[model samples]
Target chain A: MRPSSAERASSGSFELFAWLFMRISGVILLGMAVFHLFYMHFVFGVERMNFNTIGARWQNPLWRVFDFFLLAFALFHGFNGLRVVLDDYLSQRPGWRVLAKTLVFVLVVGLMSIGGYVIFTFPAAANLAAVP
Target chain B: MKAHFKIKRFNPEKDREPHWEEYELEVEPTERVLDALQTIKWEQDGTLTLRRSCAHGICGSDAMVINGKNRLACKTLIKDLGSHITVEPLRGLPVIKDLIIDFTDFFAKYRSIKPYFINDEPPPDVERRQSPRQRARFDDTTKCILCGICTTACPVFWADSRYLGPAAIVQAHRFLFDSRDQGAEERLPVLSAHGGVWKCRTVFNCTDACPQGIDVTGAIAEVKKLLLFRKL
Candidate 1:
């Protein structure tokens, strides 16, 4: 549908920042993913998989923080991409658009919170339990 | 075939508001929308107003919103659109009369892109030579005929007049990618603004609406990539 001339000037920096963030975050995510892929497949290989390997990797806080950043950025990036898709298809349907927006928001928040807590706190929890 | 052409008519001098007037006409299935419009004006109503230079698709003066899509009136067949046809001026422009919208705002954005060549260096005695690959880079965007269909179909342009609509961006892409052009740096800052190429969400409406089959979305993406990488 067409918008009248007077309604055309919706100016704000928020959408501009979002657009910039998408390009920057996309580049960062690409680097992070390629690094992870090389480390897992070529450097260590899949045959090294075991609970002990996981326990050894989490001993360092840096790796834990790296995984946390990866999880958070990837989840938000994916859902924001979905937001564009939802708007393109469901913008005309107000009710359905609201439902879709709510669902994506909940999923992003839930995944980030759960991933953050486990990634950042599991190492501390293990140390506390080891005291006994 | 018998068909009802529902045209949105408005004249500032005569009508207080735009109205849809249906003209019943007998047109062949293969007859173009332009032909149907001609029937209405020639036989039924002499005062019907529209702009069309070439009856074929080359001129691009008869772009209108037909059955919810922006298309070249000379190109769309009546049979393909079925009997019931709705013709309105292109969206996001001031309608002056029946099927003719003002292009002043559109051309302003185009002029802002500096559509002409802006290289400061001296040219050779012959053509400033460009390899086939260099020409191929911007070939798709050069086909734009200033139809305004792609611009009107763009939702971003509809929401923000400040946004340099798809047509303008495609025009910029043409020069930015040309090997002989040295004005990319000058044009880059202009397009780097908030309402620049960043506004494109790649919803594909502009590409779908282009009558010349130009890959409008792809050109936009190329411009974005050029901005991100600073290669152009």
Candidate 2:
């Protein structure tokens, strides 16, 4: 007899999520990258970009929000891209695939955790004097 | 050299449980694993079942898991393997019997990507000339022999069979990057969709297992970059 839908659902569908994440993240990265290029290169002249300028920019809540968005999207897009590559090339054995992907997940999580912490707690104005 | 082979055996009609059968054979150092298998089948066990053709690595028909790695039996030398060998069917595929795995699902995903050129223009009376550099762009992708080594070596396929796997994506890449092929627009969405190229995790196993030495991960990465940065 065929299994019910619930049984299949309960089996877990993480691949579906990963596939969806790639498309969504790819779209978001597109916007974020363009905006980043525009603001950093076009709006703020290259010559004016010193430590002080960056410090002053971060002092504003809006800039902090913008930087955070860039950081999150870029990291996720890179991690997802790496995941796809791993799936394509890694050994097919269940044990080996699980072990390798687990390692990748742990490393990505670790990097993201450190980056998120730094972004959230970054001192906005303390480095103003050092910026020049 | 004399070596022992421990082969996994299963018969749905005769046996309810799988078992291992050992065969000892005298073989030359340079003789391939397929040679030893042939020796056993001809001289010792006629009922021993397996699949092989061409006796070379080109056909991709002899792929199996040997010493915990996916490889073509026709290409692996017994001397390089060691005193004993463990041979089994490729993983992530349905087992039809002792060594043959059903390839229906594997080929189905292969065909889903529309593995052919799709140009709207009619064929010219004369052959279409391509620049040497343009032809170089697709040179590596054209080497794929439809070998399941990369697909069976992939972790994504093991976890999710629905994934198009590395081989199919690499095949899709063959056409996607070809200058003569104008279906990149239509192929990109399908290749980047669910169970498509995006599902691959770049572990480099496909690159390692590919008997043709094709850069499988590199092809997948190029596809991802195209989908991400290129419009449509």
Candidate 3:
């Protein structure tokens, strides 16, 4: 028998979108992550990444947006992959699967919110004296 | 050459759990594992049990774990497997007896894909026709023999039985890519469902396990691509 409308609605195209997001976000993440590390480590210099440097970079909204997307895509891509892992390992254990998935969901949301807030709302200008 | 055969055995009536039984046999290097098994059953132990038909590997009835790999016993040459050979039933399925697994779920998954032609426009003067290119698109998946090796070899299917498994996706690909098959609309939803193509992790065990060299994992990726872009 076909599933009811409500039941079908729950599973509708979410996995498809999730699967696509992994591939797309994976590519985006690859470029963003490599550029991030290269820019920070080589051009910007790891030693120069003090609070004042970050404060200066965040003065530009584009940097904040880039950081936000970096955080979001990495989190979604990673947690969705984790969800697949949970589905694989905990399949025989229903209660644990639900609890673990819920925990991962909470972590993704909580971390995204925290990371987004930090990226967008951190003090735009750091007191130069505080760096030392 | 003298070979040591270690077979996993279980008797539901007498044994609570499966155990290993070993036999020593002299055999030619060119002889297949099936020959070694026949010698063991015929000369050493009559109770040794296995399923085989068309003993040349086309029937796909004798898929088992030979030397820790999924292979057709009839096709695996004893020379390839070292002196110590271990034969076990295909993993992730209930072993009905020694070297025989229950294929009820495996075949059911195959049938769930609607593995037949489904064009409904009906009655070309003779039969539906297709160009060579179109026929070649799905020719790789046409070699599937419904052997449980590919499905049982899949880690996803081993972990979750609900996952349609690689064999099912390959079967679906056989029809879904057919230019004459109207079943894509029917099969795509089943392939993209929760435990459908999405469950494939692309570990490539199915491709490695396939006796027919069906490119099982590649077929699954094709199905996923079709579902994603809705293009050929």
Predicted model with the maximum lDDT: 3
Interface RMSD (Å) of model 3? Answer: 3.4
Error of 2 at A129 (Å): 31
Candidate 2: Cα lDDT at B193: 60
Q: What does candidate 3's lDDT look like per residue over B57-130, in tens digits?
A: 88999999999999999999999988999999999888888888888888777777788989778678986889
Per residue, candidate 2 scores C-alpha lDDT tens digits across B115-184 of 9988899889987778999899978989998869899998778877757788888888899888888888
Note the Cα lDDT for every prediction shown.
0.83, 0.79, 0.87
Worst 10-residue lDDT window for candidate 3 chain A reads: A1-10
| lDDT of each residue in B71-169, candidate 1, tens digit only | 999999999999999998888788888788889988888887788888898878998998999999899998999989999999877755667789999
What is model 1's DockQ versus the real complex?
0.08
For A23-128, candidate 1 gives per-residue lDDT tens digits of 7789989999889889888997889976666656888888898898888779988987777666556645769977998999998999899989877776553554
Give TM per candidate.
0.70, 0.68, 0.93
TM-score of 3: 0.93
- Fnat for model 3 comes to 0.31
Residue pairs with backbone atoms closer than 3 Å in model 1 (clashes): none
Q: B173, model 3: CA deviation in Å?
A: 1.1
Better of 1 and 3 by lDDT: 3
Q: Report the lDDT tens digits of candidate 2 across residue range A10-61.
A: 5333444555577788888788889888888999988899867777777887
- Taken in order, the candidates have interface RMSDs of 7.1, 8.4, 3.4
The list of candidate 2 runs beyond 4 A from truth reads A1-132
